[model samples]
Structures are given as structure tokens and as C-alpha cells.
Target: MAAFGQRKAQRLARADASRKGGLDERAAPVVQLLNGRARFCTTSSCSGRLVLAQGSAADANSWEVQKKNCTWLMVTHETCTKDDVMTALEKATGDVVLKFEPFVLHVLCQELQDAQLLAVRSTHCLEVPLSHKGKLMVSEEYIEFLIHVANRKMEENTRRIDRFYKCLEVALKTAISANNSPSQETENRSVYIHRRKRKTIQEQDVHTSLKDHNEELEPEDDTESNLAIFAEIMI
Candidate 1:
């Protein structure tokens, strides 16, 4: 624990090394929220991005644009326009790809339980190999179609990120509340025991209590519907 604390402090104190050289604006709030808790700290993140890159043809997969050999023609954290992608395509020299990368985050958890609590999966994004060896693989209409789909995915990604932030905030608060009250913890344990013994009768009461708790924690914006889709990778 001492070693972990020392390492975390050092990591937090160091300068950001990402390409943009700082925490992404959209993800900063959640990163700060996690770091504020003793049990977790964010190491890296991307709120999501739209990217158009040119890469070497010799790369194992024609569509796989490795950062080492690829040149980024366009990169934006926000939704992009068809003109933006078209302009970027004009600059492509090799294998060119259009991609909508979804929200990604890496966090260091102090314990196994902390990591498990945050385990979830996000929705998939779009990636199309728009050009192969300087030749367009698809029509201009298809490129526009890809852009529209990518933009929609970007919007969905933002909502997923927002949901993740809210869920984590509520979960952390609940954890802290549970830890601070020994009597409440004991009562919860007793409820668990009672439910196991008197399944039918105790289960209904437990369900009612959990429903009430969830209602209390739910945000005014009604983001609870897709709370299960938020993603986090724990290290």
C-alpha cells in the first residue's frame, strides 16, 4: 500500500505525455473524480475521437495504421464534417483509414474489488479503410455515409462517457457512505443473511430498499437507462 501510494503520487506529479500534452477536456472531470479517491487514479484516457490517418502499405494488415509509421491527417475529439474527411483524404499518400475511436480509459485501482466494481464494456465504433495505396476504395457518397455514422457514434460516445462519470460518482459516494457507517454495514449483512434463509419474504424487502437507493442516486437527466454500457480498464 505504501509503495502504491508513493508511485501514484509520483505519477500524478509528473507532466502529461500524451500527444495533445494534457488530459482531454471531456475526460478531465471523471479523471479528477477518480484521482480524488484513494482507491483509484487515471493513467490515460481519450474521451473519443474521429481520426483519418495514412500508414505504410507494408504494415501486416492494410487497414492497421500503426502510430509509429502512420501520419495523422485529421484528428478531432469532437464530431467532424464530411469536408474535413475529404480534405484529409486529399493528403493521403499510402493506406488511408477513417475511424471513429470510442471512449477509452485506463485506471490504476488500489485493490481487486475496486477494479471489479468498475468493469464494464462500451459500444463499438466505426473504422473504414477508405483508401489503399493512394487509390480510393469507396465512392465519395460512401465517405459521406461513413462520416454521418461516425458523427452519430461520436455523439453516442459522449453520452456513454457522461453516463460513466455519473455512475462512478454515485458508486464512489455509496462506497464511502457504506464504509463510514458500521451499523449500516451490519444491517446490510444481516439483510443478506435473512434473504438467504427466508428467500421469498426477505427478497421483496431487499428489492424495495435497493430500488429506493437507486432512485435517490439517479441523476435528474435520467441517465440510468444505459448505466451498464460504460467502460473502464483497470490496471
Candidate 2:
């Protein structure tokens, strides 16, 4: 844990040095809260944003260089103009996707259990929804969560982005709210523990039933992958 803190501080220093611009006004508070905690530390994060990305053809480069490949025609932490969206579209050579991302914080927790506790506490206590994306690249490091205020979706994509942009204030308010009460945190922790135990029991039951039936798990098929590829091509 001490080692983790050292590395995290080092990274934060590097990040601070690398930043040429100021922090997003809306995301600053959330970032401060996560960084101030002993049990939690923020990794890479962006306050929710709207980005105009060119299609895959424009990304002839490697997937690892996707960030470089995609032209961020517009990057905003708050509501944006429809005129700006139109301007980006005019500049796009390939398909353009307007991605509306909510303020997302990739938080590192001291322990796996601690990750769960933080997730529930932040959501239930602080009204921030979080997604548990499993472990990090470093084996010695701790668990991480993709904590954000919104869900990623392609449904009515542009319309959704516009709508989210319009309601950006509400989202920002929730993200920056000082709603973390001690009682709420305790209740959230208890609920998270209960859910974890229940999940473990369910997994055990499934394992026992599979053993009793002597049923072997089937190998994964490539049908879904092929279908996804076909869909991508069609798109």
C-alpha cells in the first residue's frame, strides 16, 4: 500500500507537469475529492465531454494509436453548440460519431473489497454510478473502477449527445455535490457486502450444480465475433 501511494504520487506529479492547460471547471471538485482520499486515488479521467471522432477508415493507424487517429473536432466539458457540431461534420472525411461521455473518473482503490466499497459509497452516497472494470495492468497495483455519471450508448447517438449536453448542468451538479453523509456511506457498504456474499453463493451453487450434473462447459464460439465484424462493416 505504501509503495502504491508512492507510485501514485509520482504519477500525479508527472500529470501535473504535463498539463499545459487548466483543469475543467466542472470536473475539478470530483478530481480533488478522489485525490484527497487515503483509500482512493484517481488515474486517468475526463469530466464528461462531447467529442467528434472520424470513422475507422480515418484510423488506419494501429488500435493503440486510436487517440491520435481520432480528430477531436470538439472537446467540451459543458454544453456545446449545434453549429459547432455541423462544422465538425463538414470537416469529417469518413463517418463522424459525436460521443457524449459523462464525467468519468478511473479510481484506484487500496483493495478489491475497498473498490467495491468505494463504488457503492460513491453511487449510493454521492449519486455517482460506477462500473467495475476489474484489475489494472500492474499486478502489484490495486483494483480500479470506471466511475462516471452517465452510461455509454449509441442509441440516437447525436440526439442523445445534444440532450446530455443540454442537461450537463444537472449532471455536473450531482458529480460535484457534497452529499456523502457518514450514515449513507455505512449503509452503502453494508449493501455492497451483502451483494458480494450473495453473488459468491450464487456462483458456488452454479459450480456445485455443474459438478453434480457432470456437465462440461462448452468452448466459446466465434459466431458473436463474426457477427460484430459484419455489423462493423455494414456500419
Return the top candidate by lDDT: 1
Model 2 per-residue lDDT at 209: 92
Query: What TM-score, over all chains together, does every model reach?
Result: 0.76, 0.45
Q: How well is each residue in 1-235 modelled by candidate 2, as lDDT tens digits? A: 8987987787677645313255665556666765776656777655456565554453433222156554555565555555555555556554444556554556787777546544421221112111111111222111112112112222233343344344543543453343456776787667666665665687679878998999986654579645744454344
Q: What lDDT does each candidate get? A: 0.82, 0.50
Question: Which residues of candidate 1, in runs, are more than 4 Å off?
Answer: 59-61, 184-235
Candidate 1 per-residue C-alpha lDDT over 1-235 given as tens digits, one digit per residue, 9 for 90 to 100: 8887887898899888888898888998889998998888788999999999889977636577788988888999998888988888888778988888898989899898899878987657787898888788899998889888999999988888899899989999988887889898788677656544564466467668979878543342335322421211110
Number of the top-ranking candidate, with TM-score as the measure: 1
RMSD of 1: 14.4
lDDT of 1 at 7: 78
Worst 10 residues of 1 by lDDT: 226-235
Q: For model 1, which pairs clash?
A: none
